[model samples]
Target: MLRLIAFAALGALVGGVIVIAVGPSTVGYTVAGIALPVFIIATVLTLIARSVGNAVGASPEAVQQAKDARRLGVARIDALRQTGTQINDQPLCELDLTVQPLQGSAFASTMRTIVPLTAIPMFQPGTERDVAILLDGGPEVAFIDEGELSPAERARLRVPGRGSVPFIPVEPHQRIVDGRRRGPLLGVGRAGRPGRIALFTVVAVAAAAIVVVPYHRAVGQSFAAMQDGRLRPDLRRPEALADAQRALEEAIGHDRVASITVAADFIIVEAPRSAGDTKTDRWTYRDGAVTHDGAATTQPESTAEQFSWTDVALDRVWTLMQDGAEQVDRPVGDALAYVVRATDDDVHSPAFGRPAGPPEIMFSVGDDYGTTSFVADADGSGLTAR
Candidate 1:
């Protein structure tokens, strides 16, 4: 059981390391969410099975004694009754048997034993059968001899030998020693309590380290990234958006920006090289840095409707839609996107119809549950939810 728990903890540690290496992204959270529950369930089932086995199964000492019992004896079943117990689908029965040794008179005794399915018919009352008993131990336990008796076996049993007893006498205080009672959590044996405690302490600390170390490392790295602006920017804030716009303008070195897209973490900007150019240069601003993403082919007609960044008030649009936007349970802040571009009448929805006007801003907000979009006219007017 300890080994099983250790393996499970190792698997969890590996998963945690993978999550940390992947960083605090959607994939990391998804893997952690699935793996943590699975690990917990596996560990719980393992402990439950161990507890059940220890409760119902024989102890190590009793099993060893049974294996060591080899003296031959004869027994006739006087009566048989079920104890209303079972082990591995086999019925445990109490048997009254008259034991007949090679040299002594027969004696009647009662013993509780698990009757194998295949041997049930052979163990009926008045049936005489070969038995093996422990000569040195108490006669509380005995095993049915299922092997065919040949002349050699009779010779060995009939002749007196070393460590041979006429019959194992039943002791009044003797009862079946199933096992020593174990603690609910550890299942340690009677002796060695201090050793078990030390071992358990070590295992507990190791298991805790397996779960905590990687988590703390991941959190620390995430905090460092946030401090360095290498993580998601809070686009729901007005100042963050303004700073992104300024960064975009500085990267492009011109005010002739075509469009801007503000996402949860980063911003995308498009700007034409010249006043009437059909191709526009694209830039991606993220982690407090901007990079040119080369040129993209733009429709000449779309380029004619370009608007200045100052024409749209993103703060007003965010404020108007923030309260009405759908919320999600994830840690993804706001879970929203803002796209400012020329109005396209083709962008239609059943809830808000088509957008037909000057340049417009489309706000997409929500998370995994669902998304709600709001279309607003340039200058943050005529906000329509879709």
Candidate 2:
């Protein structure tokens, strides 16, 4: 679920970068880093699909639930205080406010998933609230935030229409005195279908463009590619004169090409999305000497060969875990991981190291990992892994 939210939110951002690169008009005017999609979310659609679920929801289940629970719980509390009801204060389950929502989509992030709940109120700023509300009957005793009693503006704030709502529970249903509406209620603000769709579209594109693309590509090239159709400069290629023709072909795959470059003798290949960050080592003729760029490096792919250890990282592993940024219920199963051999060395010396192996791949869904995975076909061609 977290993965879904991450993806959904990030997908929009990734999609955003793509569209933003396409046209300035696309990203110039966006709300937050998101844009609404054309269709309603599957959860919303599904909720709407079931008549009972929709009723339980549109009727403000969150609001009503909060209300009812507060009522009953308060009633029990009052009874306990007065020494009356025989229903001794039995320990009911602790009302857990953290609701694990149903599975969301690839784009749903923790913030995005919870964005829906934003509509249900009594859950907001500047008010006394129970850690968990109980509904039933009686004067509810809630731990009020200091602000509720603060004399700051208690005199000015009033209940809408009916004037003042005394901070009393005479009418359990109206226990929550609408003291200081604090401006019009945002939950009541309705977003038309068109506005919703537009918002989704904007967010989707933003995710694709900003979050995914930047992380996926090198410093300049990734941005240049999407925005200007310019391929990231394989810095390892240097002048491009030594292998101009092959370099051009190696650069453009038309179809997907799984390849990585180590600064070794030649490049190793693979069929994974991460041909960019696999840990790698390079040993080649550069500047004027066959110096080693570094004994160890972390990247998803390698473009050099023979003395390349791109596959060194293949032994290291990657997994999809919790990202507080994402809102998910379960694990995701489609995260991609890159494995490298570091360098390819034929010499018996320890420095001669093992030849880099093809990159390993992992897929993820939100916080889950190790589910569906596939190997890519590599041909030892194209740009060196950054």
Candidate 3:
């Protein structure tokens, strides 16, 4: 699972880079049209290979049984000897004979006969002798006998008259199949750590390509909407607005919020309420007051007192800047235009009649374009040249 996650992340990274380079439009079609089917095919093939390999591999027990059957000693009963036969130092009840082998020492023909003394327990015709037979041929077939057998092991030898030797004494790790030897199983394949890592990396890259393209396209659409001013005003909400205010405040350190006023044709900057600072660049709006080369100034009709204004006015300025600055191609210059709040003595505007709050023209404008300062009326009549 960890490998899967890592692979996904790697895939996403690769996909994202591709999105940046090629544009999201092409990536989505390419992955959907080409990558998906290939991934499915590869996965199916891998599973099939694993299943077939397991089916053909030998079981551990089978392999061990084969080894046990090939041991130098165990012999099968071919035929019984005359009751009074004598061999070098022992009495033999049966004489074991062999078929001449086409190949040297093949187990296929070697266990044909056994000679044992009358005192020894003889198996019914086909049971193999448990004693170790000499590897080197000898007169009377020298066999070494171990003392006794466990009752459980001896009980297994009681099957009557089967032509083939049904039971062969087995060693540890040998497989018994109806008391016959078979095979040791083959190894199954497993992905090593490095191989697994590589696999995940490939998968992640593939997945990332599939996912990132669509996200890239969505972001592009959002950016285009933002640039066009067609986005919903309340889309982000109060939090977006607040975050935008904070960021603007920080950027324009020491500048009062009330001092900023949106120009009729200006840049608007703001944040959406729900997302706040996270999508500040995407959802925020900012509007600047429009200025022309020789714009006319407004003359005040009366005098008024200065007063602090709410952030509402600043919000309007941002909205207006986003909406208003469309075809206005003013020359770029070193001049900086700034909205500066009016001092008590400088608040002059016709709209500032005696009112409930300290009535004043809300804001003033200053720019490096000229030394002359000006004030803007609440209605945006024009800049009042100072």
Clashes per prediction? 0, 104, 44
lDDT per residue, candidate 3, 1-386, as tens digits? 33354445546555655454433435545544454455455555544433222121224444344234432234455555444424354543433423111112323222212244454556444545543222222111223353333455444433223333222221222223433433334222343557665667678867875766445433443454466574322212233344434545444332222223233212233222122112122111232111122211221222221223342343433333222222122222222223433334324734433332332233223234433333344433343545
Per lDDT, the best of the predicted structures is: 1
Which order, best to worst by lDDT? 1, 3, 2
> lDDT by residue for model 2 over 67-180, one digit each (tens)?
443321111111101112111232111111221111110110000011122222333322222221222221222322333223533333232211121222222112233321
**Per-residue alpha-carbon lDDT of model 1 for 75-121, expressed as tens digits?**
67768887666767887777776665443344556666678879888
lDDT of each: 0.56, 0.30, 0.36
TM-score head-to-head 1 vs 2, winner: 1
Off by over 4 Å in 1: 1-232, 326-334, 341-356, 367-369
Listed per candidate, the RMSD to the true structure in angstroms reads 13.4, 22.6, 20.9
TM-scores of all models?
0.35, 0.22, 0.25
Best by TM-score: 1
